[model samples]
Target chain A: MSMNDLIATIKKVLEEVDVVLGWTRSPAAGVAVPARFHTPDEADGAIFDSTCTHNLAVHLPRLKNSKVGIVAKGCDARSIVQLIVEGEVSRDRIRVIGVPCPGVIDVKRAWRCFGFGKKIEDAGGRVHMEGRSMPREEILLHKCHQCQDQEPVIMDLAAGDVKSVTPPPPPDKTGIRERFAAMSIAERREFWREQFSRCIRCYACREACPLCFCRDACSMQTREPHWTGGQVNAIESEMAQQVRTSHLAGRCTGCEECERACPVGIPLMLLLEEQNRIVEELFAYRAGMSLEDKTPLLTYDVNRDGGWR
Target chain B: MPKTEVKIIGFLCNWCSYAGADMAGTARMKQPASLRVVRLPCTGRVNPLLVLKAFREGADGVLVSGCHPGDCHYNEGNYYARRRMEVLERMLPALGIDPARFHYTWVSASEGAKWADVVNEFTRRVKQVI
Candidate 1:
């Protein structure tokens, strides 16, 4: 479907729900941001394309309304399923507008191609840099390089021909974990020590996470028992890192928003991708894969094989 | 490596494993001096974080001993703990920590000789690693 068709649908959806959510162009070039549509005029700005990268499902509950219409990608649709399964969001209240994904422009990777500070728009497979152009294939975000869902798993209304599209093969995580595993214990400790040391203790990774709906009620903000204070000491730094990532043991969706939001550009997703792999191997659980599949930590069996050796 | 004894931290569940350690002492069984025991009400109370905390506090290794699968005093506490530790051990290597540095087992309060054997065997292995 074209942008006009999407706008018409949004206008129709707005009549049913409290609000309609979709991607609209931000003031910055090459950036499509989450936009809430309360009226037809507002919905006119909504567009669907490669630039529509933000997973809009996260903003649904944050809109603070009982019922809302939101757009979802294959991955975003899975996030909605996991959220509903966990009872984090009400399924009956949200209307989904599933859109086909052709790999969103990862701004950071584009920076390496377009020379750091230039603003540009993406047209299909071409990166339009002012008057110059190149294939958009060269600069996908690290996670988008390996997107497996070209179509939404669940949707109230789907835009474009999802059935005709075939998803590219999922990226194999070969050598990713082994790269860190190959390091000596002391080398690994020093590696993490330096990484955590750069941490200014900003929990942007935590805040940007969709599954981390706990918000301010997070124990990271606590002081009485002091799980790990906001102070940036080496011990506290590692403590904070340990608590935050470990809490995502079974629930992470590999959205990589944490890596995206990090001001210092840490490879947080690579680390979490490894954790998700381990959770899958040990318990045969992959988060957000299906609503019918329970999270590994949330459910267990007496016959499950124990990995302690 | 130094000839000193390894600093092993044991999280023994109060209902079975803790009483098992006491039974080892009462029987005058020859147990290794390497282990420093911390007893909690049940293995369920031991969060995976505590094991990480023990390593951060400079422990050479961690041993989580609870009641046998069907024998937990709280009915199913050890069963849950078994699941948590299994996943935690699988994750340790990805974090660059040697998976060998962590282990868990089932031991009842009456198995004093078995407790001595488990402690001696684990202490020897951890000492070799560190």
Candidate 2:
């Protein structure tokens, strides 16, 4: 189904549900943000554009016990599944309208593609790409190329007809590990030092992550004998990165929101991908695959297979 | 001659290493006096983060001793502990920590003499690094 059809389906569902929560083009047409519609007229402004990158499920629990209909892409559905597994939200309380997303473009990449002097505008639900028409490949997010699962894992109500096209294959870890192995110890340190120095401490990466639910007690914001001093210096930034990466070690769903939200382009996913590789190699566990399965690090069992010891 | 002081936090499994340490003391074996032992129900209970926390809190070294792989009181506790430590060892240098500061060993209750040897070697190595 096309973008218009998906919005129309949401409009029909919202008449019965308390609210229809989904993405709409931001005032700056190049971006999309989560928005809610209580009435059909409000739904007219809803969109499913290339700029729709934010996972709508993050806002679902905040809506209280009210019945919510969310437009979930592949990543959004995984967040919904994780939330249900954690008992944060009931599956019955949510009506998932799944959309097959081909991935959204990064704003920085978009700027690079279109060059300066170009301005973006959101007209109703569509992004009017006025300034310059660059090749789609030039502006697409990197994570999209690595995405293996494009189909919604869990959906109560589907919108677009499911396509059978195979998604890009699972990332070749051997290639990644080889790249890391090739780097000299000193070069690796210098590389990370340069990447972390650009961090601005905006916390958008934390805010964008669906699994990072501990926003209230985040160590970055703590002041009592501060774990990390509240500054963007190299040491503090590196510590913050370590803390954030460790916190998401077993829980990161690999949605790539943290890397996407990073204004400095620090390649935050590299840290997470490395952790994921370690967990998989050590315990043969994968996150966000099943609600029944517990995180390997957090769960203890004496009788499992694979004799590592 | 001045003696070097090394702060070493040792996590011992209750069924084996803890008993081994006790037996070493009962046997009056001459072990290093620097080791501070914390007995846990099983080695599986020792999270790698706790070991990192000990280092971050200024311990010169950390030692995690569990039952020999198959001899865990709970049957496989030592196995899980071993895997966790193996992975953690790889990431230690990346976190700017000397990998030698974190040690993992298999000590059975019968090996009271070996427990003394483990502590002596660990304390000596820690002193050298510090």
Query: How well is each residue in A1-309 modelled by candidate 2, as lDDT tens digits?
Result: 566788788987887789998877666544667888888888888877567777777776676579999998776777778777767778788888888676565666666656533454333323345643544434556666677557888776667764543355344432544555566645566666777889899988888887777778887667853667788877678767776876776667777888878877777777777677777877777666666867666655556633554
TM-score of every candidate relative to the true structure: 0.92, 0.79
lDDT of 2 by residue, B20-114 (tens): 99999999999988999999999999877668667766898999998987788998777767766776766665555677788999899989999
> How high is the TM-score of chain A in model 1?
0.89
What is the TM-score of candidate 2? 0.79
- Relative to the unseen true structure, what is the C-alpha lDDT of residue B76 in candidate 2, on a scale of 0 to 100? 71
Docking class of 2: acceptable
- TM-score of model 1 (CA atoms): 0.92
DockQ for the candidates, in order: 0.56, 0.24
Worst 10 residues of 1 chain A by lDDT: A169-178
Alpha-carbon lDDT, every model: 0.77, 0.74
Best by lDDT: 1
